[model samples]
Target: MEGARGSESGKDPQHTSLDPFQVKDPNKLAINFAYMLEEVGKVAGTWARAREDAEPDAPVSGPISDLLNTFLQVSEYWRADQTRAIEAQTRLVSTFLDIWTNSIKQLGGEDEENPVRFEPARGDKRFNDPDWERHPFFRFLKQVYLATAQWAEEMVEQPDNVDEELRQKARFYVRLVMDAVSPSNFLLTNPVVVRETLASNGENLVRGMRMLAEDLAAGRGQLRLRQTDATRFTVGKNIAATRGKVVARNDLAEIIQYEPLTPTVYKRPLLIVPPWINKFYVLDLSPERSFVRWALEHGHTVFVVSWVNPNESHAEHGWEDYASKGIDFALKTVEECTGERKANVVGYCIGGTLLTASLAAMAQEGDDRVASATFMASQVDFKYSGDLKHFATEQQIAALESAMQARGYLDGLTMANVFNMLRSRDLIWPYVVNNYMRGKEPMPFDLLYWNSDSTRMTPANHVYYLRTFYLNNDLAEGRATLRGKRLSLADIKLPVYLISAAEDHISPARSVFEGARLFGGPVEFVMGGSGHIAGIINPPHANKYEFRTGGVTGGETFEQWRATANVTPGSWWPHWQSWLAAQDEERVAARTLDPHKTYLGDAPGTYVLARD
Candidate 1:
């Protein structure tokens, strides 16, 4: 083994360091392996500590135990065998070259403290590490050797799937020493090399991989969004083109109106509830991408309540105020618009949260004008909340509250940063590396562009939401009383249609499912594909999600109901549309803009088209 650890002379080290674990009597080799195990154990311990602090009530999944079992299995495999050795000579030669080139910094260079160093031929920003590109040939050599050595370790355990008798025997004799290379073994055997290597240059490798993947996938996804241009809405034409307008007046709160495409016969009125975090066009973004247009075209009357892009003036408005003024005022005006006793309502994201509160308030005081409450990406059960809670600490909340107090309103950029951090890989890192470092612009994405154009959250609204939803599970367990009335999910049970995205990191599917169960109404909970934007934009007529299944007899877990429910493969939208239509009537309602109550201006109200 000592013979293997020869001096670095830019040639294949003359000798190689044999793993001590392979020795029959070298107890020191066993100790070395133990040290590696300890290193991997520390990582697990850190994760466990974080888990306990993050969500103590949440169930510990079986996957963790399964992973640990695999780790143990690999360790045992490595300890017991090492007869047929890997042809690692080629790999060792390359690593030897790297060590020789780096030996200048190791011995002669001023950076003697640096264990790994290489001077760049030129100062290029593409390679951030200044001392990593000294010997290109040597670096390539190291990668090749490292890849093969790792491959050799892998082949020891993963016997090649060759049915040929002679070939299998030849393979076993020449390269079968890989019993030490199971998926579980890496943690036990290669902690120092893995950690030190990753720590030295992991950033560039991770960033490069992500950027490469993004670049490759961009064109394919672009085709999906751009190839489709069928409907009037798809071509970016809406009711505003035919017989409507988009008015953005500074008179009342941030409210947008998309009047009917044509006059209806019976005339049913409706209001849109958009989240404070975003400008309201999510419902009426573009013509084909606009749900608002769909509603208006179908003619049941529509008015979208876009949140006042909170400037200093609206800093004092809390959750209660949003519910009371934003929702209550909007509903009152909507009722007055068509002279309907109870107007139909639709809420998306946090908009749904406020709507649920309004319904609870109305239910408490007998105001069920919001005949049906559609919750899109809204969760009532805080018990199963996703990663958002990880960042919102009490101290952070206090800092935010104090900051918002000083500024009068939380900045749009501040809110945007938090959401971006929620999915840093997809939202921030790849584009950062590509556009900034590699000098490539981000692939144009309608959803991403919309998300990037953030809206300022009212100081009061932002603070209250964090405290109630993230800090404490108030709204989920029938505790959060927004405007004088406690809002239990059961309290707002009005033919609820709750939709959640399966791939959403902000709101996980299980969390959404649990929240939907809180509503005792005839709840039709849908699981859409993709993340937030892709999930919401899913039109039911398309072959998208295979997620919409039936509910259990009463409130039950997904596991309990998926057993008997009909397994269908497509978007849940058509099903939801059918259900909603069946609940009411199919009459083309005679909905004309109310002369006295209507804002009387344009299609996209100022609030809806607002950028931040």
Candidate 2:
């Protein structure tokens, strides 16, 4: 409301007229439809050529045939969607007429007591203005829009046998249509914007246009929908500022050891394996929320793996390279530094997945150096990887592979966009309104800053990850391999502690539950409160959310476990610390660093600051 503005001509801003023709042009849509038809024709031509070149009796069931079939199927689905859109528009017209009729009846005093009413869907704050319901015409228009949106959602159907990727694509396109036509998105229909336009006398519109242009330049023409400025936060100075020193460095990762806080420490050390997709500092965001600091204060020796931001030279690095040369190397360094045989290992997200594979490989080779394993929001079983599976289809993966082949790595911006879309309402749309429509600057926040500091994935490693774990789902099926040796999760009989976020969209809680069952040993699975990042970073003092923990014996479903698990308030970190304490031997004098083995410079290390 504050940022909105109308024209310089002193027109009634609340009823400011907008060019109906300028609302939306269908020319781009027509062009896209024509292009799709042309592409389909090309595919058909290629198929015909292939058929003619083949032997008379030979079946035409190869790559070209598959391509043609996919194109045809997509076109069919598009046509179905077009029909649904038409049906929704017809419903809109009928609803409009009904509203008109109802208004007349009310005007004639036939239905004065039961007058026409329009309310937005519960939790939809877009049309909460009392003025919309006060006027019958506004109410009718709002209802028509809402009804059309609902009809669009209901009518767009996917066949049972259609490719999941195609279905997902169709659903996404449908949502795009719905968002585009929402009254809240338009200048004329948005009450708050209209009111603000009247108050500001067109200045806000000029400011909004300038903001939009700046975002276009800064975000490379993509909508800059983030709430935080990417350049405001520095790694070591503010974020990931936990005190520590790098003790060892390898081709893949840097091992950092935090200085001890207490007079004595547990005999076994704790090593953290953070996801390589982003910088490791998510675990050590700031002094107030740093899990690394918490672990140190609790009298445990802490070590973390900081993976290098890879490039063309490291493009050939694979899972084996990460597992063998990354985690394996970190574990050996922890042992050498602490003078201990085993270390309690902790992995978050993809790092946890890699840790699981590495642990299984180690168990297969009869190495028992791992004291225990903890997987936080990580999934070894990809069967239920949630909406992200939409991008793992063979065709999608092949397209991604081509992109990576040309660049030597998957661009961080590409990966960030995919994750952001998973929670667009929370992460994308609000910022569109705030930064673009409202003409406001982004606010500073530590978590969002960390989110913006993303890292690239080397081509070889990323492709193998998508193919083996996501596309094939080979890890859980006992078919995945590491360094030419087949890897299986069941082989690892080590004690396990698994944490799953109740609202995590990335590694869904149910999938994490299934992953817990894959371990062939005692497992303590805990359901943490909130989504992927916030759930894990919640500190004990915050007293914000709740967690549930129980013994998981691999025989019950996630729902079953939830039904019987003990619900505990506060962070899960204390429970984990208690569990770690139980697994410890006699406490000893705090260990000192082995100065001779130390390398690299400091706490966060150079890898985190490396850019493409």
Candidate 3:
């Protein structure tokens, strides 16, 4: 009744032309803001005291000092005041959501036993607050919350000679207020952090209620686990269902097949190898967006390795098992099924890393059936990358290795946790405050849905990868060997296409392009736009993304070519397709499957989309 009265009593019904969002009581808003700020001052005071107490033994040494100074400079975050304002809003939002959710829960929304009190934003939607704030209802609500928060902060700063207990209460209120006003809370839902935060709030009545909106958002949208009806990618009986039937499977492996669109497969055989870190279908995410499907349409006979989702049951299988099941057996089948001398191979991310390893393996064995290799955003060197490197330290990797021992495979959530940390602000925080306080669902978005599809990696495979390539730089240096093979990059004398994104942290652009020097074949290395995922999924509908390419190194190192190259925007796919066509002969026989060979039902063969 009070909120309704403020909306109606303060308004001129006929003056609809006026901005309805204009709040009548700026003083109320001002008072609330003061309270929030006072609380913030206290926080600043606490940080200052902590800084003094641990004065760092008379300041850090030269380089360390420089690093600390740099850290201190950025600590202001350039939006301190904005952050303060947010703190105030968080408090109100928490209070309002707590009251609102409880009211709704009591009122009931159809489901009596476990009623859904509020609706989340569209499955994984992000909000544009300016647009929403224009509405009288939201604007009024916002003003009240902000004003209340400001007042709370003002009290914290006052000369009340308040006890530590009172000061702590003030800080909590300030934290709540800021939590509500976060940009992430407005849109972009389905974060792992939001779920955890909401769960924690469950113990604290009001705090938990504040998180209801985000919690509900996580439960419903792209972030949430959904039981979707199988999508139709082809015709009846031969539709491109999620992961096509595993035509060939055994203890060592499974060869999964996609339902073909055309009556006959391409003239040349195509092999796909996905990394064990995640599922394989990143190439075949959906009918429209799948790169694998695109190749099939262009008349290239495509065979994707649908990896087996491994658990403790296959704990014994190490990097050797994956090589045998994922790459080795698949190659054997490619040769057996098609009488062709060689086939084209595409390796994505870690799959590409492994492909490079396999190439060395093949080179050692003198198996020259593999023709051209396409590496999509895969890195061989990790030292040059930003932020991600900080977490890849020896200690961190050791800790992670120890943790993954209990279960043979690293939990999908564990990997997700690390990834989220890399870009916490972009990935985790907003959903945190908003879900807990505002009680609104973030909207649905396809990209976020794709991100949430987490994947797990076995202890052995992950450890070998971290130790061998990422930490050791063995492959980049040409010293790495797997499966007792004298693996060397120079051995795999085949044409190669290496793709990396400029802004990618997982595989830095420089690190990715570095592979060109390792091969003795024609290397067409290109730098793309977007980070790791978006860079590879460079579809036309994709946002402002691009790549840089030119000057084929007759034979050169990664840095030399990068120095002289120029950058450009748009799809590298067409360019790659063109390059791939010139080098290869037409497929002799169409894509085919044998009922004789069964799928092994394990690793990068099928469960790529279930990574989350």
Candidate 4:
């Protein structure tokens, strides 16, 4: 049999003598275990403090609990079955028997091929350690895990077993469970963790325990797994470093006017409305990836809304306030600063939803300040909103609202946790194994750093958004309203450009494509080549991903639109720039900040700097 430890030589370590004492020194291990116990005590103290601070007898089912209940309800479809149960059991046992036969053959040094064939999906790096392949015990564990996970997914996908809604929820919840229980997450089963534990003489466990305690304390009893080195990036210094000035400030947002990088600029200014859930720096992270910098260089006067991180005082703020006091206020600021009656607008994620609704209201009022509109990974229709829709059920939202009521706002970390869970395998578990299991600090990453910087959402706005948008699907159904005015997407007549990432989870491309047909004016729908952030922030210089573009005019379905789209190489930034230019080819000398106007501060204003 192969040795437990990996070898430098190409030859298998099985030929070498293995000494347990060499792997771990007994004396050192004992001392480290004592240290680990001390950290465990500290961790307990943090948990106690958290319990005291937590709301007593909080709602029965917050988001996490609600999801678990959904999983349970959906799981009844399989649990109640007798024949299905026996079939599942038979398949599982057969796979295990095959794995056993293969392990025995490998142990006996037989050259014959065995029947057990199980491989992780491509891009799965959980079992990358060499021991997982070389060591018989570890190889057996890998096969068992893969087989079980595949069986679980198969159960969820069984024909006519459950409705689509339950099936989707079941699939999502099952994946989370499977990922959380992976052999790679535990010390005994993971080859890398075991190796590290032995090589460190258990010192790694001590350090890992200390980190666990510190993180628990940091999140006030909740685990705030650090995804990146937070100390590496600072807003307005390295991140969100685009040169600009805050020209206007309101209760909801600060309007920032970026300095021009070109000698000439377009006649109309550009206003960006980013989702308030995260800091605005995502668009301005480092010079190389900064979308704000790219737009400035392309001869566009850029103005972005930096939403105030809400607190108890802002709890009363709702969707109408966000549309009027946020986007509308920013539009008025753009005109005041540039002396242009009309300006171009871009909204990202939920920001785009607000912009779309407000645009319709503006149309009803005969307000045409916005010349053209662009949506970046934003959805107006919720029929195909993906797993996120699972959290918007009437019961779940009510429970979440109760939890938020005491605090007046939904904690930023709470919202962050939801987004993280959407891609838990990549966002949650890797960091778990790296930081807590291996006792190592994560590498400094600008995107993850920005992701960690989340902002609170007012309870009123959050509840209303969940109810009106996700639950009722009122926006797409033409029943959505703002400030007592019935809003309809078809009422907005401005030429619109819509871009959706092909792999976006929060706003699926299908949902975004469906939304494109609701517009009354000419619409351009483009599909970018990555998930939400990477797809939209893809600068042309990187030349990393491709995009598909075609005019969206008819009532064709998303699949038909995709079939007819023309694939273009490289980033969609250039295409958007060309589209913007085509709106009006007129140009003028680049304008400087109005010295006579009252200014709040530099770009990336005070609101984005407000942390939880």
lDDT of 3 by residue, 1-612 (tens): 111222344542332223333444566546544554454454455545555553111111332333344333333432356765576567557756654553343222212354212222343243334322323334333444444545455645542445553344344434444444533454223222233333333222233243342233443211232212123222212222333455566553556655455566545578888765555556666556667777766667677776666675665677777777878788777776666667888888878887888888888787787788999887766545445554444555676666666656666655665576455545666544543333334565444544555666677777777777666777777677778865778877788898988777678787776666677667888987878877887765453576778756646665667677776668777778888888764544445444455654322344443333
Please report, in order, the local distance difference test score of every candidate based on alpha carbons.
0.56, 0.75, 0.57, 0.87
Q: Which residue runs does candidate 4 get wrong by more than 4 Å?
A: 1-11, 14-22, 55-60, 63-81, 553-555, 594-598
lDDT of 1 by residue, 1-612 (tens): 011123454433422222321334345435544544454454345545545554211122222333344344444544445542223444445556555555533333223343333322253222232112332322333334344545444544454432333232333322222222211123222333233323333332333334344432432211011111122232123422323443333332655555567566324566778787866666655455567666666655777776667777887878878877778878777665557766667788778877776777778787767777777888667665666664455666776677778778776765766676565534554454443223333555445556655677667778888889877878877778855666766766678887887777777777778877676577887777777767877655556766556663555776665455565677666666666666676465566556665454555545545544
Off by over 4 Å in 1: 1-252, 262-267, 540-542, 552-555, 559-565, 586-589, 594-600
Residue 165 shift from truth in candidate 2, angstroms:
9.0
Two-way lDDT contest, 3 vs 4, winner: 4
Scored by lDDT, model 3 comes in at 0.57
Q: Write the per-residue lDDT of candidate 4 for residues 315-350, one digit (tens) a residue.
A: 899998998889889988888888898999999999
Clashing pairs in 4: none
**Candidate 2 backbone overlaps, count:** 1
Worst 10 residues of 1 by lDDT: 220-229
| Model 2 TM-score relative to the real fold | 0.80
Alpha carbon RMSD to native, model 2: 9.6
Ranking by TM-score: 4, 2, 3, 1
Work out the TM-score per prediction: 0.61, 0.80, 0.62, 0.95
**How far does residue 286 in candidate 2 sit from its true spot (Å)?**
2.2
- How many clashing pairs per prediction, in order? 23, 1, 73, 0
